[model samples]
Target: MRSAVVVPETPVKSLFAYPLLLSLLVGGPALAQTATRDPAQIQAGTYAVDPGHTQVGWRVSHFGFSHYSGGFSGVSGTLDLDPKNPAAAKLSIRIPVGSVSTTSAKLTGELKGEQWLDEAKYPEMTFVSTKVEPVGADKAKVTGDLTLHGVTKPVTLDVTLVGAGVNPLNKKVTVGFEATGVLKRSAYGVKTYVPLIGDDLQLTIDGAFERRD
Candidate 1:
């Protein structure tokens, strides 16, 4: 006698299961509420710099061979903003010169030495905005007094609003920006290499500020 064979049952699949998993992995709805670039969404008040997320990057030509890059962290600052009057916005930031870093340990250490940044003499670099001119819907020209290596010079940063919204993890109102500018190292008394390492330093700043008010 042949025994009856039992058929294995096929498991049912929920149509919503795959989409739910994908949404969570790719940050669907949660990401939408966290950030926005619309200037109208920004709240008017004071915002303190989120140092952990802010950085000032520098790049310069290396003996006409390649461009070398480095960055300075441990930034602190504040932003006083009014969406209705972006031209009147105020900005002030301080960056620890000793925080400068590069891929090469020796190069990084040399940058902090007397002939370079002279971090011992100038512990910090500072910028205070003297004028904020709105150039576009989300762009501006921020002219500030940049003090580096004990010398102060007027530096204009072409700034753009990156985003403004509530930070998902910290639940704090946050705003971000990117700025680019160029300055001659000689102007700041950092003329060690001169034309060999490129006198002009290209600066790029990624700044994050959290609402304090």
Candidate 2:
């Protein structure tokens, strides 16, 4: 009789198998709606963007003119997903470009005019994260298309888990994350050549999402 042969598993197979096993153990129950407890809800909860607590700002040089700094106000959004399967997530953010403030009224108006934002035509900008990749325990990379001035472009953001806990009022477990990214102004069609403004505009986004009740 010939001896039975056992095939050796490859490292990639083992790595993928580990997640499957883990899902079978942890995610299985979390995913099983009828079999398990009610899946958590991600809407119907109070989520403050914490303008004083958060930041969505950008900087650009003026023809070597000078450094200009400004940030967004009235930030808002909703985060929906399975904490167990964070990749199954969705987010939305809206910003008013008209509200942008600069050190000078002249600069602010210039930024909002056709030479830059063209606020008359594109008054608002938005972003909705389409994909989320887990970096570690509470860190992730959020990838999505950002729309600005009638143009949409794919962008990647690095996110950090700020904190998560149960909200007393809403009675929902909430998770917080801070996401950041940067982009060139010209890429989004914001091209206003000036003696002072630099083409390389630095965009910084800090997003903190809360799980809904």
Candidate 3:
């Protein structure tokens, strides 16, 4: 028999590294499965929204010459998802209206004030889906009631499933989606500048949710 080679153990940097390492080891198999897993195989259940990973942005025409964009900072929600029966999936999201931010602090304040979003009076905006219509394998049209600026209106979003997999750091099954829609701010009673600032606003949503045990 050949002589046995001896190996030295490398010490882990910190106590925090233990869970991280374990997560990678345990999550490896799941991560691999994600690539070949069909959408129909996605676990059906309620997933808790990962607030830190969610974003909602809005773009509007600035003076008929260019487009400007801004976004809200805080978002929370639950996604009731069923992969086999995609039409059964539903979404409920809450947006803190006061979290609106742009390139300038002054503009941000103005947006929350009466002339724009009037967030002082309406502190939050929300969307609750009434129906989800699958368009293709990984896309859908989600219709819902959007409550913004104290006005409620029906809005439909073209949504696409971005990806789904086990997060190696957290070891949780995560799903991500992107959505886009348009809303007329004037219909929501925020017609400040009208044609000058643009009445129609484009909304974009990017969010991820982790499966809840």
- Which portions of model 3 miss their true places by more than 4 Å? 1-37
lDDT of 2 by residue, 121-208 (tens): 9988888888998887667798988999999998888877655555444444555566777777778887767434676656676655
Distance from true position, residue 152, model 3, in Å? 0.6
Top TM-score: which candidate number?
1
Question: Candidate 1 has which clashing residue pairs, if any?
Answer: none
Q: What are the RMSD figures for all models against the true structure? A: 6.0, 16.1, 6.4
Scanning candidate 2 in windows of ten residues, the lowest lDDT window is 32-41
How accurate locally is residue 10 in candidate 3, as Cα lDDT from 0 to 100? 62
Order of candidate numbers by lDDT, starting with the best: 1, 3, 2
List TM-scores for all candidates, in order: 0.86, 0.67, 0.83
- What's the residue-level lDDT of 163 in candidate 2? 58
Worst 10 residues of 1 by lDDT: 8-17
**Worst ten-residue run, lDDT, model 3?**
28-37
Q: Give the top-scoring candidate (lDDT).
A: 1
Which of the predicted structures, 1 or 2, would earn the higher TM-score when compared with the native? 1
